[model samples]
Target: MAGPQRNNHKRPFGNSQKRTFGNSQKRSFGNSRHDQTNKKPKHGRQQMREIKRMGRRHQNEEAKEDFPDFPENDEGYESGDNIGEEPSGAMSLENNPRQAYDALMVLLDNGKDEKKTTKKSEKNTAKVQVIDGNIPGNEDEETEYGIEDIDEDEESVKKEDEEDQNDLSEDEEDEEDDEASSDPFEYHFANPQESILENFEQQVSKDSTLKWQSTKTSTSDKQYMAIGQSAPIEEQLSKGKQNIRLDGNLEQFKIKSRMNIPFDDANITNSQKLILDSVFKYKDVVFPYQHYKDESSIRDLYAAHAVNHIYKTRDRILKNNLKLSTYKEALEQGKASVEDEPELRDQSFNRPKVLILLPTRQACFAVGEKIIEISGLQTVENKKRFYAQYYSDDKVPEYKSNDFKYLFDGNSNDFFCLGMKFTRKTLKFYSAFNQSDIILASPLGLKAILEKKEKNKNNKDFLSSIEVFVVDQANSLQYQNWGNVSYILKHLNTIPENYSEDLDFSRIRMWAINNQFKYLRQNLVFGKFSTPEMNNLIGNKHSLNLSGKVKFKRNFTSDESGIGQIVFKLRQVFNRFECELPVNDPNARFNYFKTNIVPFLKEQSDDKEGGGALVYLPDYSDYLRVKNYLRYETSVNFCSLDEYSSQSKLTKYRDGFAKGKYKVMLYTERLHHYNRFEIKGVRNVVFYKCPSDETYYSEILLRFLGDSMMRDVIKDINLSVVKIMYSKWDANLLEKIVGTQRVPVLCFGSNEIYEFK
Candidate 1:
């Protein structure tokens, strides 16, 4: 039978080969021959077998659901494979031998009648296991043969968990339902709670509408009762009326007082009363000076000026057919471009400082104004400008201890001291007051405290720190005065009781040596002079000693001319002074010397434009150029209008009287910044100097003084010309060179000349 079976299997004519059990051999469960052959190679088959064995080891582990589809497939069998294919195929027997053998065993164990079908079913079971464990669903197939059955088990488990959860939830729900339905009223009735009793009373009051009580009186008693009850009430009412009348009287009195007017025998209008009330209510509120002046009755003097500003703005709007708001806005926007006003000079403020010695209160105020003005000056305007303000105790009005303190911070970094040539009496008084309680009460304003700050560290903070000495008892007088800073000065016993040889008290001698000339001089001292060692130290520190940047003229040889004496004096008087001006350029050096240094130097040369013989007016133009170079007014736009006019237009003109010559022609220096005093109708250029100081003063009502030749020469010019001089004021020399006129001379330091004429 086996031989015949083999022969029949090999032959196509055999019954087994020819016959089919429901087309079992021909049906492939839709899998093609190519698919089965390519299913797994020998190495892949071994890997798969190992994978299967490992999987069998974890069979007892709960079957995890298919991982959510990730779009990747690892199984050898791809999509479109028919599941009906059995292990009878040679490819399957090679891929998974164990699975094939199991299928064969199942077929063999079963009777021959079911052998073919049983083998197919076993193969299908193997495929299903791989699919369940590793493979994802077939998107085209929709449903698998055993997946529904597996899902049924999952559903039953899920249902069991949900039923258990429902049981717990039902119990909790039953308890909550009972608690919510419990009778709160029963607990209230069980105990006599105070809140509960109150609730009952409140409820009764809310619900009941009928009255609970009533009272009646006889006719005779009613009449007596009315009289007794109403009498006191009427009296009290009368008292209240009287009190209201008194209050009105008091209010009226207050209104009159606040208005600064007496209401006695005067008719007070309702409007005036209302105004008085409003003013009095907030009278204690502090306001700015401008606001205070506005609220007071004194601002009417400038009504016309204010009206002019308004009229100008209104005219702009009417001419432009624009809104008042728009015109005002434009005016405000344009204000920064206007030229600065000279009148604004009066409103200036100075850096907070202790006022040591000043000429007068008016002078102090003037200095304060100057300081404030300089403080607000444009950086370009401030270049090469040094301003000083000095005040004497005499200038200060009589006041309490804290009065001066109010002028400065208690711990201010700014200090004022005895200037270069202060009177001895003034110096001593200031030095004594500097150490007094009135000045020392607040450390804030003290020079010592100010010196601690970075900005003021190098400034002279002590009287002993100054190199120049003030003359004491030069024209000594025992004039005793009280109620000024002198009041505190008198109490100080710091002055020496006995004279010493080392201490110098030759005030008159030094004064005569410094100024050996006959002339009335306005006292003013500026800049510094240094001793030889001090000069060398500063020069070395600045690298100026070794530098070849500056070359002094060789005319003043061997220290014989007055130039050497001036240099020696300068070196002796000042220490550690640094030059901010450029000394390398001849013109610049000459200008610096003429404006600052030459003023102090003794007359040395008569030659024109050499050895300080002729002074050069600092061209404000150069300063403007430098200022422009320094980017002081970066926002200003400058345009040359030479095509149509010789003038140049500047969007803004930074102020401070400055002029300079380009080559030979003098030109006004524009700030390249907005002006504060400029109005549309007013000329930007004003007060061009007249020919002579006398003529100039005659025109502007200003005091004039200077050499007649220089004055006469500059009189006709429309530009403000500042004269430069290097000679010490001497009456004989003045009459010989210029005129016999007694000119008002402004002296700077010991040897410098500065005259407005």
Candidate 2:
């Protein structure tokens, strides 16, 4: 029956071919054709069976969305047969059993999701962004499969994180490029030496007023201007830079001043121009003398010559046609006898446009004439004109300090002070006394008159009208017998005794004094030596700190209420020949005389430059000691301070040295102040002891060189300074003498020349 049944199942066409379904695969159509075993290999059937088992096992495990890598059905096999379809031909599976087996393996490698979701129904994929946190839409909100799904999700998240990191790196790179372009540090200076010379050639020298040879460079620290370096004054002024053209009427001449002269019209140096520009801008300025002469220092030039330019220019522009206008106002008000002139209205002040405060009558007269000359108003026709008035304590007749009550209450300006009695002067000065445009008055004159003048309405006439205020040689002013500058500033600002609507109010700058006046805005201060005492006038704690960067030289804070500051750049144009000799030996006295002290003396004595030397000791005891030491030990010949009997002799001695009459001039630093005589032709300024007041030490050195105002009288020879330092104190003082703020000590060798490290 089995055989018949086997026969009943149509035999497969290929021998040894077996086709089965559902546990019936043991039935085999058998034929042993050896060469062609014409039957499916046992291993092929085993591989198919293993694949089926694997499929079953995979079905039991959970399915996930994203897997790493897997094989594809297309790579495995290409079977033309489909499951559950009618058989196309008898099963001849032996033809290609290996390909069939591979297809089954492919099926087992991949699986269907447990909870079937359609392609369209599955969660939407989104672009992953590495925000502060993971993207909200797809990270936590999306549908997920199971445990394996979680693993796949984590891998996908890592890939997204890596991509986000790459994007962030790119953004950081862009930011870095922007920062590199934005913040930069480079430095430059506005005024170089070459630029200054070029400017001089183009503007300063070419101008009609200052027609010199465009400033020639000299090989030495001090420059020599042979007798006729600059063109003759007459030639420079023959064709005046500006023609005087004033309105014929005095009323038109006094048409509310509006100064319009450009800076180009003035004959001044660039440094002076800078100062004038600052003054016009209403800023206070300070000029520091380097304690010695240098090419950069223009303090004296600005003080004496440049200020004149400002005054002259202001007047020339505002009162144009000055040469055209005669004194018609004075003519209308007929002049009478001295007794019949208007009863002296004492203390009456016509607003002085520019106030120049000086220490001595000599300077006042000299500087007053200079201002007039520079104004181009010196001579109507070769005769000096009355431009600025000069008054002094000595020139004013002597008056008992307490006899003011007996004196007539006549206006001081109306009368010339003669023999301690007030008497009206020539009528030509009638308008001058009442109203001079420029005032060059001694501080003592102002101090004495203001003190005794009945403090009525016109007490502060000079100060009230001042537009520009300057104190030339302020060190001299404070050292001599004038009231302290602080007191002057305080008194100037103080409201006058009888200030009222009727009083002639001076024109104050609108920017300085506003409608809702809080304080003066643009009042300016000019000082050659800016002493610490100035702080009291401009507000104490708010004063500039010299220990820090000065007001003008560097970045400094000066936004206080009162005045503006003008600070000059202190520079070294020439190398200082510093001699840093150590004088602190145990045999200090004799060693000093033998090595430096006596040698320096002999060198000055033999120098044929017609220039003498100054020997400065710190105190009287040191002076005497050095004086005796020089005479007894070194045979050095020098003039001592005690030899002078009176001021006249002191003056003679000073002049004689300047004239080369003496080789050596010795004095204590005390005598430098007491015996104040202008000495020039100084070959060497020697220091035996360190200066107690270092600032004043600089002033003493300045005395050796003459100001442009007094240049004609000076020797105009080259200068050298020496110091015989004995101790650490001397070394520190030596540092100050070199005129540097940063380096405390300078290196100098036996050759007596500065060494740069």
Candidate 3:
């Protein structure tokens, strides 16, 4: 085997191989001789390494031919795996060492030449793109690279192709947009609205089939909200007191319940009696369910309903000169009467007519059989004359049929002036003098006549029973002379000029009177049934006095007592009368129950000392229930003075404020003690309680005063001194203003600190 292998090697090298072996042996022999001579080995190891590198390069060339990504004959040094570099040289196997080296250098030069061409092309492309307003990629970068690098050319071409494709896609998008705009909706379509509507309807039908219930109504009837139908006043009252603990502190108030007023305490009036009776009679009955299940709430809806009807009736009566028939009714009656006479062509009954003329609200709303009796009159021409005749009729029974036309031409312009003055005086008397304490109808002369008529009813001689005479003919303002009255009267028979104004002022009296008479045949008078003035009157109106029939009284008892007796008797007679009081629903949940005590609690405070400062106001439903209960109790007892005697007092003080005594001592002491409280528009000092946290305390105090809505109505009210404890004072600087009151500072550790008056 050795002979064969040697022979093979010898065949390849021939005599040169043998000479090389012989030379290697001779060199070995010489090296051995030199070793003995101790000569140092020549430094040819690096040269040997270079020769081995050349051999590797040659082998790499053959490998390159089989690989596509690798270049074959570019340079002696192979290109690394890094991007963008040319090979330095190419290597070959068959050649003299020097010749091959020279060939490799030539290859390196060609690669260098090619790399420059590629770099210049890339620069030109970048410059061209930048000039065209496109972002240049690697335009400013010149990576340090060998000139002989050839591998970078392939990588550059590949990267450039990818960039070009991306740019083309972006450019193509712009072209597509232009094409679409030119072609419009050539490739798009939309369905018609009718189809969309049909779909919508289908969806709606699938979801819910019920139609929306109408919330609008043109009738004068009262409508109840669903929640109100089952809510009982008694149940609500019980709920109100259920949470009230006997040990809890009560809130102080300037105004107290009207029921707290004493009946025999001397300030009572016929109007007050009527109001009290009406309120009480219906108090327990406010919740119809209390008496009868499944009863309609329309009867007790808004408290204003009855008042509005009264106004409407008055308007109609005023407009029609006390005529009972409404315009429509008169027209129909005229047409029916004329049916017997074929040639009658007349629209004469179309004019508006008045049925009743009332000087005051209480007189119109008088709850008595007499009011009904008086209201039943069908026709009373010249309202003032009629009233005069009616009053005079008590003196002489013959005047029952007395025509008012004979005494005063029925059109005396002087009557208008007198009436105007009388109305103004009466209003002033009630508003400025009465101080809203007593009813306004018990003192009037009309009530006296009614009383006399009643007392004389059983007497054999009716003529002798007429004790009072019509001494004065108090006139009212004429139809045209009075600006305010005329303005209201003219519009009484028609709708208001504007809805917003209707929310404030009542309509002209004429329309109300006419409507009352026009709807006389109806269960409720038509004129009294509807009108813009009536709308507001029934909506949110405040009352000051009674109607013309009832009168206010100052004396508790009197010998003549005719007027007071008449009012009292009338109220007794009509105590069963019921009407709705329409009011806006309050913004709180109304719960009703008959529990022994209230049990609801919002939350408890963590602060031990200051926690007691917090309080909760009753809900509107609770308020209503409590009010009704109190009113009921008052009504049943006829608002007796004893009712309000001990626990609380609702005494009427005076119409206007009394003048201060202006005592020098008071000015120095008690008066000076007044820090700065405002009462009835005067600034006075008052000791006040303060809160722990002044900011939170103020917020809570403001709530007690009332909300913004309440404040709007209570315009004249102003606060000066709030009860404040002296203890919570954090700053000693405050002592300068408060003086030597020995107020508790923050160091005292009191519960609350309040503003001092």
Candidate 4:
């Protein structure tokens, strides 16, 4: 550095010297550039102050344009004078790039205007001012400008966006209010406090005298009183003896054909009258009457109730429609106000309010006939087609049992669903379920519809509005498939997935809209006998009817038990097992039967004095397990018959077992229930589990043991033996078989075995 001092001379670009790019002019690059050689460039607060100064200058220029008399060289206009002064309403340049951008645009436009207007001599002056005003030296001002501007722009933009969103939301709310005010039916009302159940009770009480008469005079008696002795006296005086008698009989028949007569006019027994009163009062009833004999009267009572329900429902709907129409007309005529309009709620999800569940097509036909007769319809649409589909002309097979004969008398097809629509003077059969007033279906048929997958959902929507649910001959359903009945009940009175196109939301009852349809539904379950399954269904949570429920009690004495019908004098042994829980009873019973009963059965089969042993299992799963064990695990020669067995296979199994080719015959209760085949050559019977229907036990014994012809053929009456396996869970079955008096002794007794002859 000392050697270099020999060439010491004043440089043209000294710190004190000035330089210009365009012409001879002095220019300054602010304090940042001036102190760049000795000190670090200014940043943060100092730079921000400079930017704010530029913004103030822009504002001053705008003020000058507004007021031409304003001073240009004022203290506010001097950048240095206001360097330490806080900007008036100044936003930080780093936080608000919009202000900085405005400052920049103002500087550029001023420079262009000066260059265009001034002489070339003044061009350098304007250029120097523009460069000195904004340009920074020895620092990355471009990078700083970009970073600060981007951050400030993002924050400012977010604030603006939030403000816009708030404005839009307010506008949307205003529009919604406007729309609501314009439409009268758009507003939804809260659920009403008053229950419709009380209304039903009141109506029933008021109409008791007209609807429920207790008089003994029948419709025939009334007609006879009207005719007096005139008809009979005229018939006796007439010369055409046969024609006159026929005319008299025809008049009597006509009187009987009028089924729309009052309840007292029918030839209903006192017991039936008692049942009908409860039914008419909308009380749930479980009547275990002899269905074959009382079915006619029961059908008439329910049919009348169903028809009356339909009429009342339709009348309410029509009344509401009329009121709404009148209100609309008055409003158009300027005679009424919206406040004066009445509130009416009378509709459900769909039109079908009555469901009659039957066991077979024949039963459905009978219900349809009763409905028509009760409705007093002079015209029936599709009547012939319904008859052709449900009724059969084929000669019925000669069944040995009258119960079977009555059960399977007509078209016994179990899969059927029919819809009936009522008009002013006609009843329309085979209508769409959604358009029908009444639905008649078998459990199996309805279950199929419910389980079916459709492109459009809500296949069970038609069942959503069922108000009166009737299950006639429900005992027969247990033999078919009790699960189907449970499935149908599970889906009843549910909210629909899709509303009907014609549905009036304004007319929907508050209870229905609140999903309380099940509470208002009336259930009528009629059967020959009660089971735990039926009791469980009746006590289900969904069966909570607000009106009330009634279960007809059946008292059984030891003398009335089905066991008395058995003609065989052989000893019947009942073996009991212990289980802590009902769920474990099935497994425990199976194990005990395999360990103790199977060995005894094997020993009995080995004897040459008898044909073979028959083991009966009620549950299909138990049947399958025993079947697999006998076929694979055991060395027993056995033939089996279940619900799924083919006719040919069943015949082969029966013949082989009868001919002593098989040592044991495995029979399922369901098989006997569906086809009560006369199983012969069963010398020894072992009940793996008791049948649900107690009559089945007697039928099984009587068919094989009590048959004198079979006993004579086999000559093994004295060798015959019956063994039944039971547990506490079999109390229902035991009650029906051995009478109610013995149920407790057999179920809870200390002894594990009992014998009867």
Candidate maximizing lDDT: 4
Q: Please write out the lDDT profile of model 1 over residues 134-161, one tens digit for every residue.
A: 2332221211100011111233323433
Please provide TM-scores, in order, for all candidate models, with all chains considered together: 0.13, 0.34, 0.16, 0.64
Which ten-residue region of model 4 has the weakest summed lDDT? 1-10
Which lDDT values do the candidates have, in the order given?
0.20, 0.33, 0.20, 0.57
Best by TM-score: 4
RMSD after Cα superposition, model 4: 36.6
Query: Local error of candidate 3 at 613, Å?
Result: 9.7
List residue ranges in candidate 3 displaced over 4 A: 1-757
Candidate 3 residue lDDT tens string, 155-222: 43335335534443444332222112111111101111233233333444465432311122111112
Model 2 residue 504 lDDT score: 26
Against the true structure, candidate 1 reaches a TM-score of 0.13
lDDT of 4 by residue, 1-757 (tens): 0001111111101122121211111233343323333643233323322432233334446544433433343321222221112111101121122233333343333334443444554545323322232333312222111111101122332343354344444543322221131121111111222434445345444663222211121222121101001111111212221120101211121121224843553466544554554455455667666336767777877787788667555544544555677899999999999898888877778878899888876778788887887888797865655665566533234644556667755665565567787654457665556667898987756765575444437567889988889888887776665667878988998898887465778778877876766545778888777666665554535464443455554545566566776765777888889988999987998899889887886786576654778898887678778899888977787898764443445656777776778878998875665456667677778888777666677888887665433556347566567888888987867776777778899899989988888
What 10-residue stretch in candidate 2 is worst by lDDT?
A: 414-423
Whichever of 2 and 4 has more TM-score, that candidate is 4
Candidate 1 weakest ten by summed lDDT = 473-482
Full ranking by TM-score: 4, 2, 3, 1
What lDDT score is found at residue 18 in candidate 3?
Answer: 10
- Model 1 residue runs over 4 Å out of place are 1-447, 452-757
